[model samples]
Target: MKKSTFLVFIIVYLFFSISGFLFPFDSDWYRTLAKPDWTPDGSVIGIIWAILFGFIALSTAIVYQERGFGRHNSEYMSLLGINYILNQVFSYLQFNLHALFATFMDALFITITTLLLIFLAGRQNRFAGWLLLPYFLWTAFATYLSWLFYSLN
Candidate 1:
């Protein structure tokens, strides 16, 4: 992987992370709404995301290292980036609007795209795919959580 690609990924990832953290922290009005039984504690969300982001960064590095899929890497990266960006929108809709049900749709979109990315990454290197296993699992869990939240709150 080129240094530039890692740099870009870090920059973009940090931007999303910071923006998401600050945005939710600033929105107390929405936080007051009822949440499901298993809704993660906000601080726990931060911790989990930090670790997850590290895994994502590592997977990006692995994909970039795969010389065989140079062209395909860009395609996979773009797909992953689109899903990441859409997730930011999901963050806003889920929290700010309190649109629990609509948020489920966004989560579902992410889950599908994530699964696709996992497949793409696997084609490049199994390690790359393995790195994303946590992401897939987390998103899958989040999907179920969203469904529960949608039904209850």
Candidate 2:
């Protein structure tokens, strides 16, 4: 991918990352809720999300480089858009609304979209698909965590 293109993707991802600040995690609320013993600390979760976003940006740029806009790759683009929105919405649903069930469902969709993106991107660029693997795995784990949160709280 060209440097400019990669830089643009990184900027877009960073823009999406701003949602975390807008709907900052409610640590006080979160602490009162029952949590799984295996749950990672807030800082750890933040670090992991930061790394995953970087991976997502790189993978998206690589996919775009390999398969530019066209009817041929519309589905890939659509999934990417859906995934991005769902990814950002999680913070609002979890932190602001405190809707554990909705957040759990959102996490499920994120995982599904990530898996679909992986398949679609892999068909065009294997490296892009590989890059998304961490995101997919993280979302899957997050879904489980959300489910537990919903059940426990």
The C-alpha TM-scores of every prediction are: 0.83, 0.94
The regions of model 1 sitting more than 4 angstroms off are 5-9, 15-18, 26-31, 68-70
Q: How many residue pairs clash in each candidate?
A: 0, 0
lDDT by residue for model 2 over 1-153, one digit each (tens)? Answer: 588677758775897688788899899999988998999999899999998888888887887788775788899889888998999899999999999999999999999999999998899889989999999999999999999999999
Among all windows of 10 consecutive residues in model 1, the one with the lowest summed lDDT is 22-31
Q: 1-153, model 1: which lDDT tens digit per residue? A: 578667755864675576467447434754665676567887787788788877777776677767433564677978877878767877787767778888788888888888888898888889978888888888888888888878766
Top-scoring candidate (TM-score): 2
What 10-residue stretch in candidate 2 is worst by lDDT? Answer: 4-13
Kindly report which residue pairs in candidate 2 clash with one another: none
Which candidate has the highest lDDT of all?
2
